[model samples]
Structures are given as C-alpha cells and as structure tokens.
Target: MRMPYRVVGGTLVAALLAQLAGCGTLFWPERRGQIEGRVDPVIAVLDAIGLLFYIIPGVIAFGVDIATGAIYLPGGTHAQVDPATLRPAVQPDGTVNRARLQAILQQQLGRHLPLDDPRLIEHRGSPEQLAAYGLVPAA
Candidate 1:
C-alpha cells in the first residue's frame, strides 16, 4: 500500500515548515541588534533553502532575520565603545591628553595603551559633520 498524495505532501510540508521555523533569531539570539554587521553565511544559506520549499515562508524568514538583526555576525560594527569613558582625556586645548588617557585606559581596561603607536589614528572631523551629529568641537 502507498500513502495518498495528500498525506505524503502534507507530511513533507509539515516537515519543511518545522525546519523553517528555526529562523535566525531562534538560532542566534545573541546576534540581535547587529544591524550593520556582516551576514552570517550559515543562516543565510539555511534561509535560502526555505525558498526551495516555498517562496513566501522563505522570504518571511529572511525578513524576520534581517529586521531583528539576528542574521548579522556579532561584534563587527555592532561593538560599541562608551564615549563617557574617554571624556576625561580630552583637554581644553582641543587635543587628547595621551598620557592621561593612557593612564585612565590602563586603570579601567587593565591594559597599557600605546599612545605613540602609528597605528592609532586621530580623526578630526569637520565642524559641519560634528554639527550634524549634534556635537560641538572644542574651541
């Protein structure tokens, strides 16, 4: 005896739906809020596989993953540094007090900052750009 077409199809559809239900959020909750980071290829491929079974559910899975930022790789652009921690290093002269900053960083981070390292870049933004971000450059 063979299974009826409807029963076989229903079983296959149910199994596929179960596989698709494991969206990126369910798999990688820790990766949430990483909107601008790289997409996790594993999740991307898994979501794409859903497209083979059904277009709408696959698209929805992709949409949910992207919107919730669960599809992104953690700790790329998602890593945030607190500006308040470095505020003490900015001098009235509109320059960074490297010695003071290094000392503060050492105390807080438990590591020595190479103040004179050439790899450390200082970006002086334009006044207009600063204004756009609601920041005022020290006069």
Candidate 2:
C-alpha cells in the first residue's frame, strides 16, 4: 500500500514548522527551572534567526521558551576567588577560619557575606590536600 501524497506533504510541513519554533525550549529543556534571569545570548540569537526567516515561527519560539522558563540563564549565586589569594584564610590544619575567611571575602568583594550561613558549603581538607590546589596553609 502507498500513502497519499497530500498526507505525506502535510506531515512534512507540520514537522518543518515545529522545527522552526522554540529552539531554546526544544534544545535546552534542562534550563527550565529558572523563572527569570538574563536571557541566554546563544538562544536569543537562534530565536532571532528564526524570527528573521519567519515571523510566526520566531514569535512562537520566543513565547514557548519564555513560558517554559527555558530562555533565561541559570539563576544562582557563586563566586570564584583565586586559591593563592585565599591562602590567608586557611588554617595550619587546612580548615578555613570562618571569621577570617568571611572578613577576607568581604574585603575583597566590598560587600557583606553570610559565610556563617549553614546553608552554604564550607570546605575542610588536609594541609596536603589544600596545597594541591595552591592554597597552602599558614605556617
């Protein structure tokens, strides 16, 4: 048995239209948890390209991504301080002095930090372990 040409054509058209829409949501479904944040530039560019080629599909893409929360960057707070710079915060035992670490971080960041927050992660390691990461303990 052979399928009708109309049926095959219609199916192709529908698939193509869906393909042209919502690249962000379709491509990065894992980014769905964030409700709001800076828009991901790569995704924005892709959606804009779709918009440039076809208005309806492009608009649908943007709408779908925004609605699904896939258009925004991951939302969280994190900081990267150089291991060498943080050496002063490490104790001889390789544990960080919480108060001293907080003061160091606050001074470097020029802001108040809740280092004592139980919800935040605090790392403890041996002096040798810390040395592996370039964070040598004080003598």
Question: What are the TM-scores, per candidate, against the unseen true structure?
Answer: 0.49, 0.41
Give candidate 2 regions above 4 Å deviation. 1-22, 76-139
Please list the residue runs of candidate 1 whose C-alpha ends up more than 4 Å from where it truly belongs after superposition.
1-7, 76-139
Cand. 2 TM to true fold: 0.41
lDDT tens digits, residue span 24-44, model 1: 988888776553567889898
Top candidate, metric TM-score: 1
| Overall lDDT per candidate, in order of appearance | 0.73, 0.73
- Give, for candidate 1, the lowest lDDT window spanning 10 residues: 75-84
lDDT string, candidate 2, 1-139, tens digits: 3568889888767655655653887788887645567999888887776676668777878888777778888866666777777877776655678788888888777767777644343445666876797665756
Give candidate 2's error at residue 73 in angstroms.
0.6
* Candidate 1 local Cα displacement, residue 29, angstroms: 1.3
What is the lDDT for 27 in model 2?
82
Find the number of clashing residue pairs for candidate 1.
0
